[model samples]
Structures are given as C-alpha cells and as structure tokens.
Target: MNKLFKLVRHLTMSLFAMATLIGTTANAERLLTENFEYELGNLYSQGGWLKYGTQAAGPVQVTNNALTYPDYQDKAVGKAVHLTQVASGEDLMRAVSETAISSGKVYLSALVKVNAVADDQYFLAFIQPTSAGIVDKKTPPENTRLIASKGSVDGKFVFKISRNSATLFESTEEFELGKTYLVVMSYEFKEGTKNDVVQLWVNPAVASTEPKPNAAINSATHTGADMKSFQAIELRQGSSATKVGPEVIVDAIRVGTAWTDLFDVASTEPTMTVTPTVVYDGSAVAIGSSTTFATYAVEYANLENPIDVYLTGANRNQFEVSAETIPAGSGKATITLTYKPQAIGKHTARINFESTVSTLNTGFAATGIAWDPENPPMIVAHSEGLTPFTCKAGEQQKQTITVTTSDLPDYGKAAVKGLSNGAFIISTATLLKNGNTQINITFKPLVPGDYEEVIEFSGIKATTETIRITGTATENGTTEDREGDRLPLDDSKP
Candidate 1:
C-alpha cells in the first residue's frame, strides 16, 4: 500500500507537469484503450474515476467512505439503502476495467467502510461481472462468503473484492487473477441517468489458496500472450430486477497495467473550412493545395435539392458539403470550378458554398454581361411569340398577292424592298422625296376588295406585288401625279 501510494502520486505529478509545459500550444500523444482506438482521435476524460450511478435517492448513499448496497428493504431501517426498497429498475455500478487484460485472478479491491448492519445487502459485488461467472449478493459460491459487520474500518466502509476465480476450468467468479484494486476517493460519471455497470471485489484471501491463472487471458498484449485482458462491461440488472437498489457513488477507479495509467480523449486533427471565391471570366478557378487539401464535399442546389460538387468542380460551389481530412498537413493541392456562357442577354446562375467551419459561409456573385449586337449582324426583330396589331381589314378575312424584291444595293435610288407579300401597307406609297426625306406607308384593308392607287418608296428599299383590289372596281381610271407632297387622288378631274 505504501509503494502504491507513492507511485500514484508520482504519476499524477508527472502528467500535470507535462500539461503545464504544453501551456496553450497543441500537442499529440498516441495511446490505445479497450473500447476506442484513434484511427485518428484526441479525446480526453478528466479527474480520477467515474461512478456510473448517481448519489441521490434510492440505493441511498450513507456518509460512509465506501458505498454499500443491500437489496432495497420493504422499508428502510435507516437511510442506508437495502436491496428491496430500491424499486424495480436501479442497479449499483462502477468502472470495471480501463484497458483490457490478457490473463490471472483479476482482483477488484477497494478500501471499503461499513456500518454494523447484517443483511444480504452486505455482499461485495461487481456491476459488470467478469467472464469467470456471475455471483449474486445472495448466493456465495464455494470459496466465497459474506463477511459480517467489520464494516467500520478506520471509521468508513473501505473494503475490496480480492480476486476473481483463478483457473478457467474451475467454477468462475468475476475479477482477474493477477491484477490489484485500490480505490482512494468517491466521484461520479453523470453522462446519463442510466445505472452504472460495476464489479465488486471483496477482501482477498491469503496467497497459498490463490486459484490457478490462465496464461493467455491473464495479461496485456505487451506483457505476454496472457498479457491481454478483455475488460468489457455491461449492466447485470437494471434499476428494477434482482434486488439491489440505485443511489450509490464510487470513485477513484484505478486498474493495474505494466505501464502507468494514461487518460486520453485526443483526436489527430482539428476541423477547418476553406473558401476560394474566384471571379473568372477569361480567368481560371481552382481549389489549390499548398498541402494535401482537405477534400470537402461542396454542394450546388439552385435546381433542386443541394448536390455535392467536388474540388474538381470548384467554379460551381452552391450546396451542402461533407468535409475530408488532410492528415499530414503538408501536401497541398487545388480544385478548379469553371463556368462559360452559351448565349447572351441576362444569363444568370446561382451558387452557394457551405462548410463545416462556420466562419466561411455564403459565397455569392452578381456580374454584368457584355454583349455586342452586330459585326455581321442579322437585324431581325426578336421573336415576339404572339403580337397584337391593328388592321383596317375585317376580322377573319383572307387575301392573296404575288410579291418579289431586289436586295437594295443603293440607298439614294429605289433599292431592295425587304418586305414580302404578307407585309402590311399604308394609305398611299407613291415615292415622293423632298430633301433628305422619303415617304413610306402601310395600311390594313377592312375587307378584301378591288382597289388601287400607287405604291412606291423613293431612295429606299421596296418590293413590288400584284394585288387584286376587290370592291368590283376594274381598270379604274387612274392618273400619276408628279404632284405635290400632299397629293390625294384627283377623282374630281376624272
């Protein structure tokens, strides 16, 4: 006991010094335990030990140093919880093993303090029983028995479960063969309201009667084949069944290993977010790496649900993304996202870049479009899908005419008439030019009829078409007037 105390104090001082040396800087240490392995992690659990159950109500805790449990009673003789009164679902618990072991009589010893009470609740136990076998507080197998009221040890319940069964072939009991148990304080692990899984180690007997040990199951992988121990634990019973009630607190759980006890919850790397917002028209964009780039999955979702866009498609980062880790932190690379316009006129695209790093969020852009109309242009009007225009013609009337045109080579002389036979016309078209002005006309007939006047466009493009003016007027008297710019038809002269 003297040697053990000295050793623990030394280890604690060493660890605290190391922590102090680190100050606020980052550091990494590789240690492995039973349930978890870092593939890559840096998790740390602090303090001395964890008590799976709480220190409240049922399975009530006494001021005694060691937490004791009897099955709750039909009623309480005192506040000390007995097995029966503890209610249906409470189970007493404590941490069984920190790291796994390979071999021996697994000893679960605790400095227990008990009061002068005699009942079935007095048996020392383990919430998570060892693979050897399960021993209920009520039934003590051969070699094991319940000790009566020596409970007041140095004025507190400080007791221990000495050892588990020694030989594998023999009837099994819980703890390991060679290991020792030394619990100094009381603490609790309050992750959840669930009852803890624990194993109880009673007072160990003398050496000569010690059970045999299995070579492989007695130790750790580093020690020998028997060096590895499988210390997996689970609840023997819940708050309800089998008698023991809840409400117990155990602390300072320490197990023996070839090496000193190491507490770690460390992970390899911290998560980060990288946003490369590029404005590229004739330029290039990429997710470059000065080191191995964390392959974060980028999302693009203007169309529907957000989609994943990789570093390869950097130009379009517009959706949700999953982050990838860059382990070594050195080999950087870049991913490029590109977008090119197909047509003109207000081309719009929306993009969003989301990352686990909360700081780099919302990448957006609103750019201007540069469009030039004609180098060798076609000046055709844009497709007006459906246009409404007024026509002097009656509704639902059909008319026909033959039309031809000459592509106008000269503007000063009557030139190409771009209009076709289907073109609309004005009241008159006798091309009359004065100064730089030329006359152009258009008209819509109310109904199909025989009608005529003149059609011309001087110094401009024109098309000639044969018309069947119907009003029953044939070869109607007509005259050409080199006349004034206001020439109306001279029907009176005729």
Candidate 2:
C-alpha cells in the first residue's frame, strides 16, 4: 500500500507540471501589429499610426507594391512602410503609434529592408514612449525614458540602447546594405535604478518551426525614473549629412509578450465588394467654376491574399480620385471623389473600379455652364450730374447722385475721386425691384472751390461705367468794404 501511494503522488506531480507549462504558453498575447499591407496613399496616419520626422523630413510612404525585397515580394507580405529623408541629411522619418504602453515586458519586432545604407546613417526601429501625442526626434520630450536604435556607424552596423541622453548598451554586429533583416527588441519595465532591462536580437529566426530570437546582440539595465509604461513607438531614420539620402522599408511589425507572434502572415484572399454604387449629384457646373461633391465609402471583405483595387475613370483629369487601399484585414475603406467641370455642356464619365476578381463601373453625370466674361451685364448712370450741383462753401451742402446698373458689384467696390476737401458716402448699393442695381451716392462740400469727382462702377465680367461730376462752392454770405473797411453781408449795412 505504501509503494502504490508513492506512485500516485509522482503521477499527480508530473501532471501538474505539464498543465503549468501549457498554461504559460497559452498566456502569450499580441499587443499591436502593423503590417503596412493597406494602401494609405498620402494619408498621414491610419489605425493609430502617427508619423513623426525631423523638421523638413518627408513623410513615411505606406505602400504595398515594393519589389525591392524579393522575400516579401507578394502582396501578402509585400506591403511596407517606406521611410526616407528629403535629401536633407539632417532630416529624420518616423511613424509612432497612437496607443500608449505603461507596463509589461513587451516584445517588439519588425522585418526591415535597407534599400541603401550610407555612412553615419542611424535608424531607430523601436522607440519606448514617454509621453502621449507626437514624439519629435529633434526635441524628444523630457519624459522620454529609453530608445532602441541601430545604424551603420563607422562603416559597420551597430545596435544600441539609449536612456536619458546616455548610451546604455551597444552591439558590434555589422549589417549589409540593401538587405532584409528581422529585428526584435524586448523591454522590461521596472522601478528604481538597475532594475529596468532591454535586449535586442538581430535577424531573429522567428519564422522557423522553432521560433526564437537569433541572438541577443545587446542587453542592458539602467536606473532612471520609475519605469512604469511606454506611451508610443516609432520607426525612425536619419543621416548626418545632406548628401546621404537613405531609404528604409519596414514590414510585418508586431508588438507582443513573446517573439513567436511576429511571424503572423496573411492567410487568405479577401473578397472585394463595393456598395450602393456611388453616384455624384447630377447638377450644372459653371465653366471656370468648381463644385465639390459629397464623400463616399467603399467596403470589402478581409482576405489573406491581398488584392489591389484601382479606381479609374474616363476623363481622369477632370475628376480627382482619392481612395485608400483596402488593408489585408479591414472590411471597409473610405474614398473621396471630386469632380471639376472643365468645359461647357453635359459631362459624363464612368468611374470604374478594377480589382483582382471584379470591376465596378460607376456612372457619373454633370452639366457645365458656359460663362462668358465679355457678355456680363454692364453698369450705366441714371443721369450725368448730381441732382443739386451748387452749394455754399461756408455752410455744408449736400448732393445726391443716382447710379444704376445690371451687374453685381465687383467686390463691393465703386471708386470715387476728385472730391477735394469734401466727403462722399454711398448709402446703398443694391439691386432694385426692376432687376437693375442702384447705388445711391451722396457728396458734401466743405470749402469753396470747383469740386469734381469720377465714379466708376465695376463688377465681375461686366463693363464698368465712369462718370464725371461738376460742383461749385460759394461763400455763405458776402462782405464788401467801401474804403478799406469790411462791411456785413447785408447790403443795407454796407
């Protein structure tokens, strides 16, 4: 009975250990992954990707048609984030995640393809965030705790971990130019000095049946502010000289608790579908004038085998096609189409969608209005002079001039001049009941002199009118002197 009891106890202990191992393996989770499989042309950010770069650095290009890396040549793995400086060596390009991480021993990995590597070129593949919003490389925030960077320094590839403006760890491994490499970084957050740890693995063999980091090229533990969490990350690249313009392509980026999840690839071909057949409003557009239509969206099914959706239309120049490529796992994408009337008469175009398996021909119609500036309405004066042309100089005098036209005012401006020491005001410049535009001009004289003014009426595409005015200002009363002595205006007194 004692031997049987011992055997039972041994079996129970073995079973418990196996269960614990299995549970540990199942607990691993992926925190974030960005494959760049979607076509986000001209978009600054999507799916929480916020691009950051040096003051004049070009934005990162998210594309899926790169053939530089043959290993990821297919669309499934072909999509990548292309980063390059704008011919300025001092420029940096980076795309940071909107999500923030505060705690955990997180693993970050990505497949990076260096199209051209030059001397003194630095590329920071993963950045541990310290604060929210945008993280600028030129002036990193004070809370910035750590950064993992690699580059070709002194004609050799080097990996480094930096903390609080200090280099914590660096690797001596060398990398080749125009080559694809898998990089993995593990960051363990802890409180107090010498408690936080960071490790890096280059060309990690995570895709193999037995997945693991190739080898730890660099590792370090440093003391700083309590290492609590990271708010964002970025893939940054820059150079030290204006002549060295290097381009880096990255794909299959993953952040998780373990390195195994970084190998996740698209497994199926998505089904494509567009809904409701976008139809722009059928309206008349004026020639040399533009109108914008409402925005619309396109929907598709997520698939493993990536497909390209091309939006083409007849008379492409007249219409602007703005759309983002449907990502590998996204079910919907929005497209904004704008049409500008180029010529007069009816304009018809077919906006067609071409995909791997289907095509949608969207019919659009618009009418263009012919606008001739030379035929625009003209402005004419009701009469030549003011109603009352004469006024007393010493006593303020007023006159009314009625101007009529059949055109809209040109920026609400009617130039009036030749009123010397006199004031003029337009009480009204509006259309009358008979379809004619009437402008009421009032002029007041202040000093005795021949007052004259030219009023011009102008409008868009309309022949304007220029009118001349004549006015006289006389003394309010006359004083006469018989023998060097002035007399009052009353003739009797004189």
Candidate 3:
C-alpha cells in the first residue's frame, strides 16, 4: 500500500509541472508580426491591412527602403512602411489574430526612424474593435501612441507617450533624426475601471530580461475609459494642419504578451565597422564661417561589398559630404564632412552607412554650433512698431525696449537720434551691462498726425545697431494695434 501511494504522488507532481510549463509558453505567444513584406506600393489592402481616414488623402506606401538596428529581432526584414503627413492622409490598420485581449498585459514593439517632424503628434496607435472586427472611428482607442515633437535643443527631436487622449509624457533625452530606434510600449489592463496603465521604452536593451520605461501614462489621472479589448494596430498619418504627424519609416512591428516574445535570442554580427560612432565637430564657429574638414572611415569585412552613405537631419543642409558611395574594391574608405552654418544656432545631423551585401547598418552623429562673440547682444523693441504705435492726441504712451547680452564683461552705451518733433521723449543714456537692460521710450504727441524716429545704439563692442520707430496720433481714444517686429541684428561685424 505504501509503494502504490508514493507512485501516485510522483505522477501527479509530474503532470502539474508539465501543465505549468505549457501555461508559461502560452503566455509568451506573439499575436501579430508585421515586416511589411510586399510589393512596393500602397500599404492598404496588402497583407490583411485595411485603409481608413479620408480616401482622397491617399494611403501609406510600402518602400524597399528597409531599416535595421543593432540586435533587432526582425533586422532588415522584407520592406518598411513610409508614413508622410500630407494636408490629409489615409491611415491603415491590421487586425490581430487574437482580437479580444481582455486580460493580462499587451506589449507592442517597433523599429522607427523619423525623417521629419514638424509638431507634436502621434504616428502609431492601437484600437479596440467592434463586434464585426471593425474599429469605431467615433471613440478614441486606449492606444500606445508614439508622439514626436521638436526638442528643446535646436536641430533635435524628442519622443512622447499618450494613452487614449491624455496629456503627453515626454522624454527629456533628445534623439537625433535619421536614426533607427527600438520602441516598446506595454498596456496593462487592471481588473477595475479607469485604472489601465501604459508605459513606453525607447531604445531599451533587447538582451535584458526586464526593461524599464522612459515615459508612461496612467488612465487614472488622465481619465480615459478602460478598454475591454484590443483588436487592431494602426499606423496613423494625421492631417498636416491639425495633427502635423511626423514623416517616418516604420518596420519590425511585433505584438505580444511578454517582452521576450518580441525579441529574438540569437544575434547577428555587423557586416561593416565604422570608426568614431559619434562624429562631433565641437568647434564654435561664427555665423557664415566654415569648420575644419573631418573624416570618418568605413571599413568592411568583405572588400568587394561596398556601402552607401547619406546624411539626414534638420541641419543636414549645413553639412557637405565628400562621397556618397564607397568603392567596392577598397577595403575601407574615408568620407569627409564640412560644416558651414548660415544661422546662429546649434547645428546637428546624422550620417548613415548602409551595407550592400547584408542588413548591417550604422550611423554617426555630427554636431556643431555657430556663435558671434563680438556681437553677442540682441536689442528688441516691445512696441507695436511693426506697423505703427497709435495713441490719441494729448496722451502719453510708453514703450519698453529690452537689450539682452551674453555673459560677457563688456560695457557699452546707447543713444537716441532722428527725433525731429519734441513729441517723443527718450530715456537718459546709461551704460549697458552684461545682461538684460530695459530702456523706456515715451511718445506724447500734442498734435494728431503721423511721426517717425530712430533709436541708434552705439559704443558696443560690435557694429552699431539702429531701430526704426513709427507712431500715429489719432484724434480719438488711444489703441495699441499690431505686433512689433524685431530688427535684424547684424552678427557679421566685428
């Protein structure tokens, strides 16, 4: 009797362990995978994707311009979807195999490369389906939105997250344009109402078992109805006027319940090697001045297989490359870059090298700044002088002008001239400080007529600056109309 009881206990434990293994495997199932492998054309009606939005706006296109990132599971798979925001554009959606995912957490991952982004808008999202497997256009989906906008730094952009229509939670780290990044979003469906959570991870480590998020949004504070289930994943090309969505290339979209399901365990080696992954021209040149030429070497394992090189970014026009195509015979080639900035701001761009024989791709960042130390101060008039400042006769109107200078220990003076009529009274001359200074200009016109004057600022370290001020004295009550225009401060003069 004792032997029989022990055998039964062992068999029961074995069956329980097998059931647990099966359940764990089932939880890691991938529901959707889209590499956009199809003929180069419209993405609608291809590979079970359907078109929505305004038909006249046209559908997103599938291009052979595929993108690859380091360690991405679906590196350089078939093709990619090109989404460009027009005046109005059509959006596409593909229904997932498991339409009703009510419980557990859902993970969405994609490899995205932004070419251009004008304003803050969402480019990708997911929506719940109706009984007939159709998305409800009237209701906003509990989505994993990828929002892009101009970064605080010039010539850079940042990504943000928005769950449903909640406020956006943006990332502080700025990203370079024309670079591929792996983005992962997870949506957690709580048991209660209005308690769903969404989190976003940008460029997370694929090899890590648990990856943390860069930004997140919760439905409790943002206030969005809890989603019952998610049916389809969408690529939105929002209207240029309102949405102003970004122009981006999207690839390697995967939807799963676990993080490991979205990434592959095996890794491939890079075909080509690039020296100095980040090419930074740290020299601060004056506006319109050119920086010293710099070169980046691209060496390939196979000499016969060449690579194509290109530049893309907001400040890409400021840079010039020596060669576009690296020759096949040469095992390595040098590409020179020259930075000649026209504007007085930070300039940045990216240089992408794509291999001809393999899916291996890499890029380097280039950055520079243009500044004028001699003429670092800026003068701005806060009056309605773009058209004319208007005031009634026998009334005094005051306008404030601010002079902002860089943190340089330079002292200067300013004076007003071209005041023919005694109607205009100017403030006393004072020495300019290194920081901001406020100057007052009072217009007390006794007669009802038009008047003009000029404020000349001199004795500064750089060139002499001037501001043109005009005013109109009306017979009726005073009125302040039109916004003031800033005079172009010449930064060329030493």
Best by TM-score: 3
- Alpha-carbon runs more than 4 Å astray in model 2: 1-26, 53-56, 65-75, 87-99, 118-121, 125-156, 207-228, 239-246, 264-494
lDDT of 2 at 370: 29
Instruction: Return the lDDT, model 1, position 69.
Output: 23
TM-score of each: 0.22, 0.40, 0.48
Report the C-alpha displacement of residue 387, candidate 1, in angstroms. Answer: 12
> What RMSD does model 1 have?
22.9
lDDT of 2: 0.51
Itemize residue pairs with steric clashes in candidate 3.
Answer: none
Which 10 residues in a row give candidate 3 its minimum summed lDDT? 133-142
Please report the TM-score between candidate 3 and the true structure: 0.48
- Candidate 2 worst ten-residue window by lDDT: 140-149
Model 1 backbone overlap count: 113
* Candidate 3 lDDT score at position 487: 82
Give the per-residue lDDT of model 2 (tens digit) for 1-494. Answer: 25796467446646754664565543266766666656666324455554454444466677873433223223455467776754542323233334656565667676666655544344553454444444544333322221223354533344444433343444446676566766677766655554556666675443523344333322334344333555455555453446443467767767776555555544233345555334445544455665555344555554433434333334445556565344655567765566665543344444444333322223333222223343344556666555546767655545555555443322334677545544455555443311454566555666676777776666544566677766677766755446775655867865
lDDT of each: 0.28, 0.51, 0.72
Higher-scoring candidate on TM-score, 2 or 3:
3
Candidates' RMSD to native: 22.9, 21.5, 32.5
For lDDT, candidate 1 versus 3, the one ahead is 3
